[model samples]
Target: MIELNVAIKDKYYENSETAVLSQLDFKVNSGEFLAIIGPSGCGKTTLLNMISGLESCVGQHISYSSNSSGNRFKKNDLASDCSKSEYLENEQANRIGYIFQQPRLMPWLTVRENIELVLDPTQFNKIEGLLAEVGLAQKGDYFPSQLSGGMQRRVSIARAFAINPQLLLLDEPFNSLDAPTAGRLRKLLLDLCREKKTTVVFVTHDLQEAIYLADRIIFLSDSPCTIIHESIINFPKPRTESGIAELEFQAKLTRQFPLLLAGKID
Candidate 1:
């Protein structure tokens, strides 16, 4: 089943003559991990902002649907200005989870409190399990400042999954960390997604990261971004970050579009 269908005819910055994204379209399947990778300013973030309703798709040729069963972001509903906090409410039971570039945890709150903040009262009970799942069970009482960057990121992952969201959006959530830390977190994310049966739409500029994580990847062009390349990772699950198969696949991609993987648009 298709979990998300996004077709944004075009997006532009106010007072700008050039379009940031044009004729962009993509769909994510239920329980599948989809990654979008492109150069630095290819409207990757803007595309996510539109999907999460942080950016208005008003007066544009954008059509987004969360799944017919949930009917989220219906074509006519594109005008709605829904903020991230506004989505934490149980009222929007569609449960589309999102992990921003930063951990975005409140400093004053403890790790547990940070997770509890986004969850409904009924889900507060999941905090302990989630904390353990993210390897932060003992640090639940620790503040965000007390935790390492990777641990803090784990909290963000836990918070998003706490909602048991059917669709999760991540915007370069691991780009800043060291290789080992990011690798561990990536493995954690993979485990959680599988256990929870979550469908993910991950955005990144890292070619290997996308290759290591996604079932399929969509590469975008530069400004006026649109799909430039599509590749499906056929290696079975239980794959390593730089496994032989992954490296081989990555090599093939690099050979085919050397410029594209280097964040130079094809």
Candidate 2:
């Protein structure tokens, strides 16, 4: 399980500070797929960064708990940690895998090489299998430049799963794809998540995407983002658009989207 109570601030002007997110508290149960949706610039990416240890927040209190052990850390713990290796080791950070908005692949490396770079040497033998899992078995030797945008994103997904992370953090990774492409990728993601039993925190602006993928949906307010509304998605797994389209609960949630954006909900 992951628990977070965090606040974030940024310098908007020379002497002024703006609250990007405030008092956002939520918990993601083990093996649950949680989706966060909010207006643009509402610190969605910032939240992911904090969780991934990529960025720090001013008033952060987060913890990670598993069957074996648990650790609690405050914002100060991150600042005082001197080495990346030490911090990762202490926080069990190696169990985290993040997919950013862009593919972020290296131009010089082939697809297989890029994925292999992050995998443990002991797991090198699984590289071929992982590539095939993402439908890139034939393209492993191809460089990023040779693939289409969607294919590159597939490579990114394969790279992330290569580590077999316990927790996956995705930051609008499909925002740029067309609707059909995005839908296909979402199914691919769902299949992998089910197979791995990994906990996921997916950030996206598309309500339909959230409805289709998440076990629960969290709606956030604008800047100084807070959870204004949340709903449990009871749809059965291996979901499809046609299957959910006829559900009244899905319709109710769809109607609530406007109110969520208007911050009219209590």
Candidate 3:
């Protein structure tokens, strides 16, 4: 299992003294998709940055712990007591993948080259397999500018999985795609994660997306953000649009979500 323990903490913007994420406590379990949603300007992005250890933080600590699922591991556990920058540098050694809001691939590189960029030179052979897995095998020669937004995102997702990270962090990764395409990609991504048993922590503002993808939904309040609600989605598996049609579940979740966002939950 991959676990996240975030204690009550505070963080501020550089130079100025203003807390962005304050007094937060949250946890995510393995094989789980925990989606976070909140009001505008609620510091959701800042909270994600802290979890990925991309930014410096104070007053609280976020820790990551992982256990095996009987698969091949390339190296020792990447979890460590290191600074954010230092941890980012060890990407090659870690199994934590990230899909940013933007498909931040290099324009100069072809799709294949972009995916291969994250792998060590010795792992070049792994590139083709990852591309095929993401359904981008035929577009290997195309550049980012030549592909549709969905295709570009696929390449990004492929690159993130090339290293087989234990954690996958997504920041509204499907924001640019059409509904059907996004739904397809979501299924593919979920399948891939099931194959690797990767734990995911995703951030999004869409309530439907949250309902469709998350095993648990984490709700954050406005600025000086803190988790106000953590609701488990107990619908039966292989979840689909049809499953969410349960009037009881729909009414219950829909009715409570507003209260959660409003910080009115106990």
Candidate 4:
């Protein structure tokens, strides 16, 4: 299980010193797909950063309880207490794979090289298979510049999975893509996640995307963001846009969207 309860302060804006995240308390089950939806500038990325250990908090902001050992590991002291290697060596620490809003591929490296850079040397054999899995079978020699934006994002997805992470964090990865490209990427992501059984936390402003991709959806209020609605998506997996756009499914979400926006969820 994953647990988080924290407050965030913006040092640059001291005049209005309210916490960016007033009270965030939630838990994620192992191997679950959880999507967080909120308005822009609502601290969604901040929450992901905290979970990934990119941001530090003074108190007990995040904790991971391993199901096997029943041991709880805290993130509060990570930065100050351990070196990068030590942290990775800790059995309780989660191996994280993050896909940012942009592909962020290395401009100088070939597609294969970029993916290879993050994998263990022993796992080099898996690179070709992953490239093929992402539909870039013959493009391994091409650099980021040679690939289209959508292809580059595919490379990024392949790279993230190359690490064989236990937890995956995605921050609006499809935000800038066109509709058709985004749809394909979403399906690719779902296929990969199901194959790997990785616990996923996806943050996005797109309601349809969240509803289609997640096992459970979390809705947050505008900044000083907090969970206003937590909903289970009963739709079966391997969902497609056509299926989600059906009148019945759309109507169900339409009715819930207003309550979610109004923070009227029980």
Candidate 3, after superposition: displacement of residue 99 in Å?
Answer: 0.6
Off by over 4 Å in 3: 69-93, 242-248, 257-266
Candidate achieving the largest TM-score:
1
Q: Which residue pairs collide in model 4, if any?
A: none
TM-score of 2: 0.86
The Cα error of candidate 1 at residue 227, in Å, is: 0.6
What would the per-residue lDDT of candidate 1 be over residues 82-141, giving only the tens digit for each residue? 443543442264567899999999999999999889877887887998899999989999
Error of 4 at 112 (Å): 1.0
In the range 1-55, model 4's lDDT, one tens digit per residue, is 3333333433112356667776677777777899998888878887887778776
After TM-score superposition, the amount by which residue 127's alpha carbon in candidate 3 deviates from its true location, in angstroms, is: 1.7
Most accurate candidate by lDDT: 1
Quality of model 2 by C-alpha lDDT: 0.77
Kindly indicate the candidate among 1 and 4 with the higher lDDT: 1
lDDT of 3 at 172: 87
Task: Assess candidate 1 and give its lDDT.
Answer: 0.82
| Candidate 2 lDDT tens digits, 99-217 | 98999999899998999898778888998998888888899899999999899999999989998877899999999998788888889999999999888999998777788899998
TM-score of 1: 0.88
Give the per-residue lDDT of model 3 (tens digit) for 62-148: 666555555423223223455555555544434567899899999999998887777778999888788889998889999899998
Model 4 residue 253 CA deviation in Å? 3.8
Using Cα atoms with residue i matched to residue i, what is each candidate's TM-score against the true structure?
A: 0.88, 0.86, 0.86, 0.84
Question: What are the lDDT figures for the candidates, one per model?
Answer: 0.82, 0.77, 0.76, 0.78
Worst 10 residues of 4 by lDDT: 4-13
